[model samples]
Target: MTDLHFECTGARPEPFGASPTLLFGLRIEESDHQPVHAIALRCQIRIEPVRRQYEPEEVGMLGDLFGEPSRWSSTLKPMQFAHSSITVPGFTGTTDIDLPVPCTYDTEVASASYFRALSRGEIPLLFLFSGTVFTGRNGFRAEPIPWHKESSYLMPVDVWQQMIEEYFPNSGWLRLRKDCLESLRRYRSQRALSSWEQVFQELLATAGAKGGD
Candidate 1:
């Protein structure tokens, strides 16, 4: 019967990951100073919408995810951000480890949309922890971590934006339906467009000229 305390000290962008990632500094302390062998940790991270205020522009950008500002009282709720698992090495009383969380820029996801909408400030995040904890003199005991173990952290929005910029670099991504993509490909091929940007610009110009007439 050991009680564990979790705290997130800070976060930073991972340098050499395949996808964009943020590594959070996690400190875990056990109530009883027993020799723990390891922890098979699983954490559910949530974005708490009501924990922070939003700018007018942010609210406008986030309307698609949470609806209008007027309706936020009902709509403002925790959003599932990510789920990550790690094997925390054993310690006597306390230990610090890196909690790596994979991130995406897919606007279709509510968490990603919410993150993109924010210009500045901290993101209120809740980490719910569960799994098996191994302990004892020779790693003899195994027990289940309590369900109520949770921790809150305010992650700087700038950190997330910076990480995204590092990977995307002044660009955005979108996933199109196969049929729509095929149609766009055909359009591009018909005009011998060199790039998708050009194809889109040509379409916009054609639409504008038609509207002018």
Candidate 2:
């Protein structure tokens, strides 16, 4: 059996990734100073929303996900952010690896919406780790990594913002049904709307006028 420890030192935005991605610094340590042949590490990252305080504006934005602020006591629960895996090469004592976590800008996703709602402060994250550990002095022996292997890290909100900005500058993603998209397209064609922004603006103005009536 091997005793393994995990820690998330920091995180940063992946500049050259094809999509919005975050790289979390993962440090793994072997307690007994044993030579680890290899490791197939799988991690489940979760956002612990109850661990941090929310601003008034943030609370308002998060209403759709967590409901009213007063109901947050019960509604605020951990949300899954990403599930990622990495192959760790053999090491004797310890090793550091980059955990690549692919992210999406779709506002329909709970994690993305929660992240967008945040203005500042760190996001409390819980990393649950599991996988196979290959180790032995004479030869390689396969063993299961304990389920209790977990770590907690406070990721700065700015990092996420930076990643989003890099991938989508001054823009946001909204997923709509096929029928709704067709309807929007027809509306845009009929009105000769040059851009989606203009279409949305026109619709909002019309809605406001109707509301005042």
TM-score winner: 2
Segments in model 2 whose C-alpha atoms lie over 4 Å from true places: none
Put down candidate 2 lDDT per residue, 66-114, tens digits, no spaces: 9878898999999999999999999999999999999999998999999
TM per candidate:
0.93, 0.98
Clashing pairs in 2: none
True lDDT of residue 112, candidate 2: 94
Clashes of each: 0, 0
**Span of ten consecutive residues with least summed lDDT in model 2:** 53-62
RMSD of 2: 0.8
